[model samples]
Each structure stands twice: as C-alpha cells, then as structure tokens.
Target chain A: MNFAFTEDQMAFRDAVRTLLEKECPPEVVRARWEGKPTEVWASLSDMGVVGMTAPEDAGGLGMDELDLVLVLEECGRAALPEPIVEHAAVVIPALREGGGKTAQRWLPMLAAGEAVATAGLGEAPLVPDADRAALLLDDHDGCLHAVEMSACELTPLDSIDRGRPLFAAAWYAEKDTKVEADFELAFDRAALGASAQLLGLADRMISMTVEHSKEREQFGRAIGSFQAVQHRLADALLRLEFARPVVYRAAYAVARPGECAPADRSLRVSMAKAYAGDAATDAARAALQIHGAIGYSWEFDLHLFMKRAWSLAAAYGDGSFHRRRVGDWLQQREDSDA
Target chain B: MDLTYSAPEAAFRAEARAWLDANVGPFRDASSNTADGFAKLREWDRLLFDARLSAVSWPEEYGGRGASLWEWLIFEEEYWAAAAPQRNSQNGIFLLAPTLFEFGTNEQRGRILPKMASGEEVWAQGWSEPNAGSDLAGLRSRAERVVEDGRGGWRLFGQKTWCSRGAFCDRLFGLFRSDPTAERHRGLTYLMVDLRAEGVEVRPVQVLDGEEGFAEVFFDGAFVPDQDVIGEPNDGWAVAMATASSERGLTLRSPGRFLATADRLVELWRARGDRSDPAVADSVVRAWMDAQAYQLFTQQAVSVLMAGEDKKMGAEASLNKVWWSELDLSIHEAALGLLGDEAQLDSDWLRGFEFALAGPIYAGTNEIQRNVIAQRLLGLPRG
Candidate 1:
C-alpha cells in the first residue's frame, strides 16, 4: 500500500547523491565530455555504484534493481559521464543470466569494477561508450554474447550527448562468449534503466531551470514570474512528476517479473521508456526556453543535462518504438482475453 | 515500496465489493442530470450510507468506518469497478466536509456531517459569481449582520453562478463580504445558507450537453444563522482555500474514476478493431499509460499523507488536478478519434466528453493550477 521509499532505500540514495556531488561536479563532467582521463568510474566503483546490482555470488553488492534505479537517478542528476548504468544495470545482469565458465571469468572483474562494459541491447544502431568499454555485450540472433573490446571493430560516431561516446561495433564471438538466459528480460531491464536515468535527468533539468528563472531578470522582473514562463515550467514539472512513478513502477515490474505476466512486464517497461523519453525531452526543451540564449551556449551547465537527456531519450527504445510495443502488447492481451 | 493492499485493506475491499455486488444495480434512467435521475442517485447514496459505504474514511460517529486513506482508496476502486451509482452527496462529503472537520466547531460537525453522509441534505458549492469565475477573490456577495433579541446572524445577498448540482441541492456553502471597508479576499465570511429559505432563488443553467447540471443561486437577503459560519467572521479566505484544496485534490477526483474511464476506453478501442493502425494503437497505449501514471501518483500522495506530511498536499493537489483533467480529456478525445463521426451517435463517449470538458475549468481552471505550481511549488516569483 505504501509507495514511499523505505528508510534504507532513502539512505542508499542519499549516499549515492553525496558521492556524485563530490566526485562528478560540473568540471569533472566537462572533463569526461572532453575525452579526458577522468577518475569518475573508479570513484563510483569504490562506492560500489558499478556493481550494486550484481549477484552476491558474483562478488558484487547483491542489490536489487530498485536500488540500482535509485543510484542511476543520482548518476543522471549529476550527469555523470561514466558507464555505470551500462556496467551495473545492463552488462552485469546480462552476464549473470548468461552464466557459465564465461560469466565466472568476467563476472568478478566486472562486478568488482576492475573493468567497464557497454551493452548493445537497444534497437538503436549505436552502442554508447563502446570506445571506452573494456568489454562489449552485444546481440546476435536474439541472443547476447560477451566479448572483449579487442574482439570487436568499433567505428566511432558523434552523439549529441558528448558524455556518452557512441560507436557502431561489429561484434564477434570471443573466448568468453555465452548465450544469455532471459534475453528479452535483459533488454527490458536495459530500457527500464535508461528510463530511470531520463527521470533523473528530467528532474535535474527542472530544478536547474527553476533556479535559473528565479535568478534571471527580464523587464525589471524575474522571467519566472511571467505567466507564460511559469506555465511552461509547470508543464515540464507535470510531465516529469508523472513520468517518475511510472519509471519506478517499471523498475518494480522488472524486479518482480515472476509475479507479473510477461506481457505486463514488457508493457510496463515500454510505458516507462516512452513516458520518460517524452518527459525528459520536454524538460530539456523547457529548460532551454527558460534559459533563453545562455542555455543554448556551452558555458552553462544546463546544456550538459539537456544533451544527456536528448542522448538517453533516443538511446534506449525511443518513444515511438516503445509506444508501438505497448500498443501491440495490449492488443495481444485483448485478443487472448476474447 | 509495496503497492498491494495490506490484509485488512484487502478484507475491506472484498467486503465493499460483496455488498455492492448484492445491493447495487444499473441505473434505469442512466442520467443523473434530470430531476428523476437526481432522485434515483440520492436514493442510491442513502443506500450506500446505510451500508456504511458512503464515506469509508470518515469517523464512525459521522456514518463511516473511520478507515485509513488507503482503505478509502481501495473502497473507491471497488466502488467504481462495480459501476455503482455516483455519489450524489459528493459536494458535502468530499468538498465541504474536509473544511468542516478542519475548522468547524464540534457542534457544527456533529450536526452537519451525519446528514451529509446519509444524503439527507445534498450540498452545492457557491464560489463563482458572474464576475468572479477564475478570480474568486473578486466576488461581490455580501452577508450583513442582523441582530434580534441580543443575538445576531448574517443576511446574505448576491449571486453565485456555476453552482454544481444547484437545482436540486438543499444547502449552499459559500463566501461573502462581511466588511465593506475591507479589500478583496479580506473581511470575507464562509456561510452555509438553506436553499429553501425565503428570498432565495435557484435557476437552472443548461450545460453544453443540454443538461441542468448547474445553476445560478440568488440570495435576496437569505438568512444564515451564526451557527452556520464555518470559521471566524472575516477570515473566510483561508477556510475557503482549505475547501478549495479538497476540491482540487484527491478527495474530489479519486483514482478510481479515471481507472474506470481508462478501462472503458480500452474496451472501446478493442471493440473498434483499429489495432492494425499503429497510430491508433499508440494513442490507446498512451491513454492507458496516463491512467497508470495517475494511479501511481495518487498512491504516492496517499503514502505521503499517511506519513503525516501535509505541507506538500496543496501544490500536489494543483498538480494532480491538472494531470487527471488532461488525462481524462485526452482519453475521451482518443475514443472519439477512433470512432470519428460515429462519436456523435454513441451516447457513452458523447456524455463523457461533455462532462470531462468541465474538469480543467472547475475546481479552478488548469491555468490557475499552473500559476499555483509556478509560484508555490517551483518557487517562481508571482507575476
């Protein structure tokens, strides 16, 4: 009956927030965007942010996806440039499912933050952080294979979200490759993780824009005081607020899949991805509109969150793709019922 | 966090479902806008009161089980899912009763709540004037003190337009100017007047659907005893704001109504056989998602209330009103979009579309809600 986070969950979230506040400030995020050798990954690894979702037998914290969702939101708020979500939420879960001699060899290293990984589970053509990842988890014939970066050829590409380096990786089966159990579930988890990130990014954009509106004056009054500006900001807040619970519910749906129908699970994930995608875009657009010209510039930190919003929104299944999936799922449910 | 009900809540839901299953029946007239339909709805309300299902969250003394907020939400879900008759006394139970509980004297609650819960006295809100639609502070209704035998009460005079359920309502609750020298929003008094009193008039106003769901109430010196005053004589603004919060918040628009609406829309979409069109499917899915969002958001708000966090309710109420109203509007629009011109022939969707049109406009328009969010929640400067 209760939807509020438990005391333990709140404390864990606060811990992640504190770590990101100290480790991934604007300068650090900028450095990561500039292709600098940043310590953000190692710092997060030290905080167990990289392996919180891995199983206990895999030498990780053995946390749930809800916990991972909490941490990912902080990563989004900080606009942290590391592949923590890829490493923890996607790769580790996929590797755990594809358990074997291959998982045993890499699971400890990946779970212990000894290496970083990127997942190519999305329908998007590009894989994020492929250039920086030591390991690549790619899809082949609807099954996942884990391979070393050296086993793949990556053609680098530019993304609007510079913090995430994108590449089209032609992946080949390597020594540690294995078929994963629950491949579809793994993909749903990835999209849901991205949804959580977008929720965080959207919320961050809202606060930053609100703060900007209060500080920025136009025609002898704060621009935020204007009804037009206020309404747009209100719309942004509305979308984000509504999108958030769906994202959390998606996380819950993923965490307890056995308790839910498969169609319901996928539908919930799609709902999260689609809603967060649209909401984050709206928040970013509203932030830009509220900031006027300064938000368009690279000098303001607002662009960092906005670009990340655009990148993450399209990275996982985009809104149109997920919405269609939802429609199809519900239609199937109706047919079965009939 | 767990979204499933606890054991007691589940039991309560089952009890309500069972009672409703046994006692509730479909409307013979299927329209609550007409006089006969209104009487039928009032009878149903009385039936629900007798079953102790009218206001589950209120105290036992006030004809309720004194259940928790979660239980009330559960009861609402079952109530709506069963397609039970609408609450005819909602104006009294949800809108006015919260204010009464918060500000009324013990005597006022003891006298007023039992009748309200039992549907013996149906109430209507009298907030808007001809000149005071969105800006309620500009209302010119006045209530002057009249003394007799060393005891004094107020004589109310002015017009209150857009009074929901005014035609059949037995009582009126509204704010009036108590001091001529005071400015807007100041020196106002919240009064409860008997609609049957002398010098009072109730004229029905036809809504867009050609239904007499609303009316304009005129008071040519309608008498309201001192006992009917909600709060201090000149501090009605704050009292009215309390009621306004209830009107805009969870009390008025429970998640159950939207859930039922969404479920119906899904059924309609399925029956329409347009799933092959990707655009159609996308619209249906979006509607379902919006309903889920609202349900979860309301649960979150209820959780906050259970935790005794009252400060966030006001802004959250405003956000909630905007969210549900827009969601309801879009769901109806999607239904019509699916049917196209056939929407004119289907009475269900047609009536739904008509009623939903008032969502954003009433309980303060969505525009005013945004202003509240921007200034109060976002801390944006007031324009």
Candidate 2:
C-alpha cells in the first residue's frame, strides 16, 4: 500500500538524475538536436544505462522496468539524445526473448556498448534498414527476425525529428540466424520504448514551458501569472505525470512478463503508448503554444522536443489507433459473455 | 526489499478465498443488477461482518478482525477473485470508521462501529456545497449554536451537494460553518447528523450512468447534539482531511478484481478474433499495466498506513487518487475505443463508458489532485 519509492529505488533514481544532469546536460542535448552523436550514445552505453533491462549474466545492468523508467524520465527531462531506449528497451528485450547462442553473443556486445542495435516493429509503412546500427530486428512472416544491417539496403528519410534520424532498411533473412516466438513481446517492448521516449520529450517540454512562462513577461507580469497560462502549464504537467506511470508500469510488466497475463500485458503496452503518445503530443503542442511565435522559429530548441514528440507519437501507434484498439478489447469482453 | 507476504497472511488469503467461494455469487448476475443492488450487496456485507471478514484492518474494539494491513489486502485480493459482492457499507467502513478510530470518543466508537460493520447503518459524506465543489474550504453550510433545554448544541441549516448515497443513508457526517464571522475554513465544525431528522430533505441527482448515487441534502435547522461532534468545533477541516486522506490513500478494491476484469477483457478480445489487430491488443495490455501500477501503488500505501505512518497518507493518497481515477477512465476508454460504434450500443459496456467519463470529475477531480501534488508533494510555488 506504499507507493513511495524504496530507498534503493530512490538512490537509483537520484544517481540517474545526477548522471544526466552532469554528463548529458542541456548543451549536449542541443547539440544532438543539430546532428546525431555516436559519442553521446556510446557514453550512455559505457555508463551501463544503455543496457538497463538486459540480464546481469549478459554484462548488462539488470535493472527492473521502474529503474529504466526513472532513468528515461531523467533523460527526457534533460532532453538527452542517448539511444538508451533503442538499446535497452528494444534491442535487449528482443534478444533476451530470442534466446540461444545468438543472444549469448549479441547481448554482451549490446550491453557492453560495443554494438549499437535498434528494432523495427513494422510501426511505419516503410521498414527501417538497419544501416545506422550493427543489427536490425524485423517482423517477418509473423516472427521477429534478427539480421545484420550490412546485408540490408538502408535509406534515410526526412523525419520530423532531425535529432534522431529515421532510416528505412530492407533486410533478407537468407538463413534463419535467429527466429523467436515473441513478435508480440517485441512489439510491446518497442511500444514501451516509444512510450519512454514520449515521456522524456513530454517532461522536457513541460519544464521548458514552465521555465519560459516564469521568465517571459506581458502586461508588467510574468505570463505565468495569467490563469490561462498557469492552467495550460498545469494541464501539461498533469498529462506528463499521468503518462509517466503508464510507461513505467508497462516496462515493469515486461520485466516480470509473467506477473501480468498475456492479454493484460498487451493491453497495458498499448495503453501506455496511447497515453504517453497523446501526452507527449499535447505537452509539446502546449509548450509551443505557450511560447507563442518564438516557439515556431527554428532558432529555439522547443521544436526539437515538439518534433520528437510528434515522431514518437506516430512511432508505435497514434492516439486514434490505440483508442480504437482499446474499444475493441472492451467489445470483445461483452461478446464473450453472450 | 521483499514485497512478498508472510505465511500467515498467505494462509488467511486461502481461507478467505474458500469462504468467499462458498458464500458469494457472480457479481453481475441478473438478480443482483437491480435498483436494490445496494441492499443485496449489504446482505453480503452483513454475512462477512458476522464471519469477521468485514473491517479486517480495524481494531478489535471496533468490531473488526484486527488483522494486519498486509493480511487485510490479501483478504481483499482473494475476496475479489471470488467475485464477492460489493460492500454497501464501504463509505462507513473505509472513511468514517477510520476517522472515528482516530478522533472519535470511546462512546462514539462503541455506538457507531458495530452497526457500521454489520451494515445496519449506512453513512454518507456531506461535504460539498452549491458553490464549494473543489474549493471545499469555502463551504457555507452553517451550523449555529442552539439551546435545547439549557443544554447547548448546533442546529444545522444549509445545503450540501454531491453527497453520494445521502438519499439512502441513515446518517451523514459533514462540515458546517459554526462561526459565521470567522474566515472561510476557520469556522467549520464536523457534525454527525441523522438523515431522517424532522427538518432534513434529500434529493437524488441522476448521473450519466442513470444511477442516483449522488444527492443534494438540505437541512432546515437539523439538530446535531454536542456529543455527536467529531474532534473540536473549529477543527473539522483536519478531521475531514483525515477521512479524505484515508479514503483516497488505501486500496479500496481488490487488485484481483481489476485483474480479473482485465483478464475477461482479453478473453473477449480473443473471442471476437480482434487479437490480430496489434493496435487493439496493445491498448488492452496498456490498460492492464496501468491497473497493475495502481494496485502496486495502493498496496504500498496500505503498508505505510498499517505501520502507523498515517501522516504520509495526505500526499500519497492524492497520488493514488489521481492515478487510480485516471486508470479507471483509461481502461474504459480503451474498451470503448476497441469496441468502436458497438460500444455505444451495448448497455453494460455503455455503463462502463459512462462511469469512465465521470472518473475525472469525481473524487475531488484529477486537476485538484495534481494541484495537491504540486503544492504539497513537490513544493511547487502556488500563486
């Protein structure tokens, strides 16, 4: 009945927050906004944050979902452009579920910051060619196939989030390098990752809005003094807070996948995506609105978060898509009784 | 570090589950879905009270099983898993009973506790007023000092709105402005008023779910004896907050109840062959996860309270209130979204949809909860 974080969990959260504040400060985040930095991603890997969800035996941090969520929230708040979500949330879980000698090999590399990996969950119409990463996990024939990016044709698209470039890649599984019965789990993990990313983006946007509102003045008072502005900021804060637990809960479920029933887990992942996606989008939009004309200019960093939120919102599934999914789940329950 | 229950608690869970299995019927059976559903539910509550299953966390002096908080949670988990009937005396059991334990006189406890536990008396909250919804401190419900044959007490003459179950309840505990000249919140007093008093009237308000769960109660000089007062005269706010803190803080329902419903949701999804849609499955899974987090959060809160750390309940309960209400809404909204147009057509599903719609508006509103978190938990600057 105690919702307060344990001392260990709090210490872990503080450590992560401190690390992000020190190493990946706002300047580094801003730099990543202009161009992707392999070094920054590598630094996170070196710190063991990149492989937070990976097994301890695999040279990973072996942290639970809540730990990862705490880290991700800090990363989001700081607007740090690390591939922790890509590496930890997507790649590690996908590999762990894939399991075998392949996992034994890849998990260590992924955990050690030696290899950069990302998952393509068929979220978009065009597939991401794994050219930017060492490996690509794809959904093919109802099974997630892990393949080398060297064999695929990689093409970078003009994505909304310039900070994190999106590359569409085509890969052929010439031989079954590794096949797993966890397309759903991989999808959930990927969605959870997207949710984490959205949370970070939303949180940063809220902070930016709050700070800017306090400093920016109109009618001889800080714009924050205005009830309209205060209410908007409050609403954004609420959305971010609400989305936060959903992302963490989803990650927790994934960590102890058995703790949740399969359907329940699936529903949770979807709701997290839906809520986090919408929250991120809304917060970004509100942030931009609060900033007025200044936010629309490319000179400001607000666009970076706004674009990231937009991209992430569409990454796993949009609000309408998830909402419909929720509706269908409800209808199914009614039909069962009949 | 270990969140697992002790052996005794586990044993209690099994016993409770077995008892519930034999005694409780399916929750939504046709016969139990009528307007008198609360009465039917009260019967089950009385049975549980007789069996020492009701108010398990309350002290033995208050007619409870005097179980540990962990054991109480386990009892709830197993009870919900068995699809036990809803307790009609929940308002009294969850809120008033805890408040009485903390602030009530021994005489007050002796008189009220047993009847509440046995479901013989239903109690309702009389907090909100016409102008005081979220701003509860601004409540104008007046209680003037009155003389009854040289003995002094308060005579209540004001209106209260959004009083859930007030129309049906036998008694109400509420706040009133005892000192009109004093500033808002300074003059308030907590009084236990009989709903069946000579000058009292209760008018039910129909909600979106087509249920009259809430009511507006008017008092025309309704007499509340001095002995029935909770705590000091002007300290009603503290008592009210204590009651609210507990009500919002603890896990009122069994985690197993939500989990069961979530499982049924998935089963329905599969039955309709909607599992193929990754989008729908994802939303369902997300709802379930949110529910789990809520359950975990509630469990944590219960543990804290049982360990006699009631002060932490103030901020933590606000968190629980926000999270659970939003989760409830999200689960149903996800359900409605998945069902598409068909959701609007189905009565039961529609009721769930309507209930979800009201989630944010009730229990002091998610907006207010966030404000409390910002002002109280985070120490944010409030203008």
Query: DockQ values for all predictions?
Result: 0.83, 0.16
Q: Taking the candidates one at a time, how many backbone clashes does each contain?
A: 0, 33
Q: How big a share of the true inter-chain contacts is recovered in candidate 2?
A: 0.16
Best by DockQ: 1
Q: Which candidate gets the maximum TM-score versus the true structure? A: 1
Q: Give one digit per residue, the lDDT tens place, for model 2 in B283-313.
A: 6766775666566555655555665754346
Interface Cα RMSD, each model: 1.0, 5.2
Model 1 pairs in collision:
none
**Predicted model with the maximum lDDT:** 1
Residue B287 error, candidate 2, Å = 7.4
Docking class of 1: high
What lDDT is reached at residue B22 by model 1?
84
